[model samples]
Target: MRVLDRPTFDGWLWLDGYQLNKKGDAVTRRELFVQQAGLRKVSTPAPVPRRGGRQVGSRPSGQPPLVRRDRG
Candidate 1:
């Protein structure tokens, strides 16, 4: 599965079609290859903003807005 050249537009090269290589097969093989390769689409989990009734915008001291410095 080598991309011979860059796409005409920039985004993501969605694997929605089949491709032929050095072999002589000409049949569309996208689904077959994806299934064989155990590849599937997945959804990413959303970030959990706050927990235990803690406000995401303020600290427990009830002072000014808390700055989110480190996300690491």
Candidate 2:
């Protein structure tokens, strides 16, 4: 679905009243389209943010963060 307008002004786009977003790994719009629907693009957002909030690498305050180190 294409976002004709951002009435809500959130990061999410209106998938013609459904919704379309690529947030994290639970499941994405592209995955859903690949499984059942077809993917297409009319006009996408002009500038997808270079750094998402967490991508900035700053941990939340007052929280002891335990991170997992991935093996290459």
lDDT value, residue 47 of candidate 2: 47
lDDT of each: 0.47, 0.46
Model 1 Cα lDDT, one tens digit per residue, 7-52: 4344334344455444434467562222223554578445444435
Model 2 residue 31 CA deviation (Å) reads: 51
> Which residue segments of model 2 deviate by more than 4 Å?
1-55, 66-68
Candidate 2: tens digits of C-alpha lDDT, residues 1-69: 334453544344444333435532233343111211344457745644445567455678898776879
lDDT of 2: 0.46
Cα lDDT over the full model 1: 0.47
Worst 10 residues of 1 by lDDT: 31-40
- Model 1 misses residue 53 by how many Å? 10
